[model samples]
Target: MGNTMLYVITSLSVGGAQKALLNLASSDFSRDYPPVVIALVEVDGVQKQFAEAGIPVHVLGINRLTQLPWVLPRLFGLVRKIKPQVIHGWMHHGNLFATLTWWLAGCRPVLLWGMHHTPEKATLERKQHALVLKVGRWLSRFPQQIVYVSRRSMQRHAELGYAMQHAQVIANGIPLGNNREQAAHYASVRQELGIPANARLIGSLTRYVPEKDIPNLLNAIRLYQEGGEDAHFLLAGEGMNAHNPALQPLLSALPDAIKVHLLGVRTDAQRLIAALDIATLSSQREAFPLFLAEAMAAGVPCVATDVGDIAEFVADTGTIVPVADAAALANALSGLLNQAPKVRESLGEQARQRVAARYSLNAVIQAYQQMLGKVATYSVSNA
Candidate 1:
């Protein structure tokens, strides 16, 4: 554990930040750093993935803000015991907690912060995040470096008074090889979803949150269906099912001919992507969504809103539309769906190439390794 790097995140949930951390932890880069993960709250989801990868994960059992006082001492004790060379924080609450723990433990490790979101639109889920940004402006000197998953997120945080001098941008990366096995399951996945073999499958992998704008996607699907397109939709993520009262009305309003399968929190997302003719994202806010990258890696063309870095990621490989514009989304989907098989395949190839060249997991892992090496040297010199 000489070069141990402790990763502190708000939780070990199956979101973008947690997924990125898992990628980093499971990669060859972790061999040099020997990464350990610490969740501020109790480890719920995706923690097993890290453990299975031979990474040690610890939970502080701090479920809410009220538990901070009791949990801080536990964090301090862990810091003193582990004596990690670096303390890397993910997201707002985790960053603040890491900074506090570093100060309290009197540790000499280099501190780094990671930001995975864009604060373009304020929502109740992000109210605490807004407060953290305000407080981070004053405590910006704590972290040796702050890594933003997208350039847009870096710019937004800089504008919001975060430390610009120490900021860096590192986009999320996906393992291209991870989808290779999924090709074998494509037909089976479609059959499992009750979709016809020839039906145009438009899929979205996202949590059913207000920011995701899943209703807008449903509206677009309705419009496309009204035009007599034979399509099926596969939406797989948390809160995507009809069990939610708010989404039941929207789900009920969809046209009868369009087959919609709501598979909540699926483990076979890559296989679902493999079975799709097109992937879609209707998010109002994001900072380089992982699903879009994953879809492209799976050689699936995407139709997404012009939010965050989605347009930049898709480039000419796919289509982009304005947020909340169901008509534009429908038109884009219709155009892609109407394309010849050869044409669509060509576009999908371009998407896969783009991801391979820019967002490969190996490249991202090397980037983090380089950063960690520098931070380690800096900390040793200062010590």
Candidate 2:
């Protein structure tokens, strides 16, 4: 098996899939076969991290589908130069793009695709996305292998007419350790926000997107507050800051006694996750909620609405509630708070241990490396 692999994805933005790619590419197991990131469009910041990992990154510099024709030449040239033994796509558009590259480059590398989304998105997906999803089903058999981060994603895609013969599930992983030092930083963060020492600091690390259901989280918080509890809520993600006009009214509606601190697009998620008394997620859709896994890794007790593979992973470590039910989410959060400090601390340690045992970064990278090795073998034999 040749130790060269190329990864294609729609964008290199700071999201779960992007972070998973970064973690896999930068890990020690991937040192020999570093990533050749082919982003469909130019996005900020992550390119630098890839470069620092000694991975080559290529951005097509195109925004709309109309611009794809202009970038085909450049894409073909990259494939020719790299001559990767296996070409893997990250998502729907990326899978299609890699398929196009396989045809245009005339370099028959073994092709693979990665699917990170679930069917929950299809309910409200735009026309363009619907078209891509349709195209993916029609062309799903081309990829030698298709990898999903969760069992639910794999099963749903199969029901949607995707080929399942060559598919497998490889869950996302995070760097694991007891983040005592990073967790301690939460105290200073709380102090800066003027939160009383005795107050529970509940934190959520998520992007403010429709699928994430920020409104659902706000409603849950409001319900909890009305139940005679005062807590500090810290939400860190893109469009979560005070500057977002859409989010301001929701923030204003929360009782002044219940503070919600919005820190937009922070790079220090580990520090924030470690310092929290509880971490929560209220997403309407998800595959494998990376934030909860990260929170568990950081030794924070979690209270998340059951979605994706969240219930499977969280298990007995944290509380799970019904999706979109603010009352249930609020009750779960309050239940965690009602526990003794030592009890919560014990649960946090158990959460950290669960993450370490199942979803370590090393295990995931090794799984990818092994899978690609098999693909390289197939490529060589088929050639």
Candidate 3:
């Protein structure tokens, strides 16, 4: 009920969940529940984004997960010093560290775990997720709660044998910026990129990873081109490398006429969305992507694979196709091109309205505020 300090996340890069954390940091809700963010890892470039909103941030400077043991004592010391009302975690590593640190700190700030996805399997860069899950189960004794960005993620966790009752769905929101400015920015960006004035651009804004199914979208584009459409496709995001075995061969194999452009990550996603005639998300697995919400906020008609809670958010507003189905995705994309301008505009309006009503920046922050209050109270009562 009083001002709440939130030790939010610890990540090396500023990704979707980090952006969501930024939105929360920038909210006027501080008038009701003041929030503080502490990144357990070095708080990458996101610190500036929060600082622009006059929010002070703390970084634990955890350089590597292997150094977690070295960081734990300091992390605990920092948490005790800060004594936030709620110790919240954003993604898996952050969640594990925050939950463990809070518990070790005698659960000073109520432990609130933020689950961004169905826990990802271990990769060469990170430890196994099963080990993380074991830690979560062992630490479930604390008054811990979860905030799932979508119901799909919540269901996935339950299917994996985690407690469903402790989790709540809090869909991430898009920042309500100046739509006109976004449009102008898009115009300049398109001009700079050398896109033809009349060209129809289909954009897929996602990290170039295996789960994202970037190849599926490329295949769909191939299908669209083979059927005689001259659409320009842009794939934008950071961390894309054609050298990685998972993605390298596919990039090499793309047809010359397909005209694929990889515009590595940009913070000005709204501008990119504004430039797009249509936005696409070809992920084979998603909980609820901020990209889809962002595209809709820019009033771009979306064609997304029905992977996460996308169907629920996009109901009747845009096109949805089965995951990895090139033909179905191609049909959906083509179906929009022949539609009247007024009709397409109406669809775009619907997409924007959906975001405004349900996924607005204010709405999501309010939900977190309320959830934080409840978790803090619950933690205190049980303690």
Candidate 4:
């Protein structure tokens, strides 16, 4: 018999939601509460992450989940066969599929839906959002509890009018590895990227998507340099090739003194974080990004846009600027950079302390376990 099973958005690549779910399903929490994972569609690489952690994964080869009304009965068949104690889903697509599958299976398997971002910030074309929003609100009724990566995310859902009394905010946790190779890793990366040894490094780790607003980051860096702040910018992540052709133009417009290293999608994000003098997040919207938490855990001070739960997360440890305002972002970066080294160092230290106290993987997983137990008990009692 399988354990509490989770159906996810995709298992192919790593995202914040994927990383958090994998951490939980493969965590030591399994020793106290058994678990299993089901990927809704064919996904690669993730099986390896799970297998390495001794967690089992099952993938349904559904080509397009957007046509879930047609695809759900088949998924319901799979759930009926597995008979897990609970069915948890991730992202909007995964939540819809899992909730429908649970209802169709004729079993209330302690449905839990994970919302990783504010819906208003989704990449979906605006024309399609109405249908997606309607479906999301309808399906939300079936879940015993809805899990959000940040309070801001939950609030967005409520603002969108998806009222559920069981809504909860459970931020994502990150397990930053030991800083064994911290200095060496940064030195090597910086050298390879051709960044100047003495130049101030201001960096960000984010996928090059429009919502991430890489253009604003480029403009912010320009402002930083224009104000006589000698700096280099490093953007580490892959670009959505077809959509993000703006990157090349931004790079071409820069002077040689301001280096912009595009370290395309890396598993070594922590190493990249360690390589920087300062880090940033200039997204138009977000839900407590992994980059911010990872940078904090790696003891890097950040200046980010006041989006999602960032203001709540940063508190006084880092600077918060308004979204998409390059001038404001540049000013904040300049101020943080110009501070005394000890002052910056102290801020970074406090940032690390905050992450350790509230955002450790072990602590977040324990919270999920308690929530899962409540979900299970409520489902059983109501059954």
Q: Which candidate leads in TM-score?
A: 1
Go through the candidates in order and give each one's C-alpha lDDT.
0.84, 0.85, 0.75, 0.78
What's the best-to-worst order under TM-score? Answer: 1, 2, 3, 4
What are the clashing pairs of model 4?
Answer: 237-265, 238-265
lDDT of 4 by residue, 3-86 (tens): 656565645465667777776766676776566676767744456777788776777767674765766666666777778767
TM-score of each: 0.95, 0.94, 0.90, 0.89
How well does candidate 2 match the true structure in TM-score terms? 0.94
Per residue, candidate 1 scores C-alpha lDDT tens digits across 1-383 of 68788888989876778888888878887777888888987744787778889999899878877987887778878888888877888888788877876776575678889898787757424767667778877888889899999989988887877778878888887978445576666778877877777777889999988889988999999998898777788888888887978889998897677789988876656777888889999999999899889889888999999988889989999999999999999999999989999999899999999999999888798778788778767777987
Which portions of model 4 show Cα errors greater than 4 Å? 41-47, 61-77, 104-107, 121-125, 196-199, 240-244
Full ranking by lDDT: 2, 1, 4, 3
> Which pairs clash in the backbone of model 1?
none
Clashes per prediction? 0, 0, 1, 2
**lDDT score for candidate 3 against the true structure:** 0.75
Predictions: Cα RMSD each: 1.8, 2.0, 2.9, 2.8
TM-score of 3: 0.90
lDDT of 2 at 25: 78
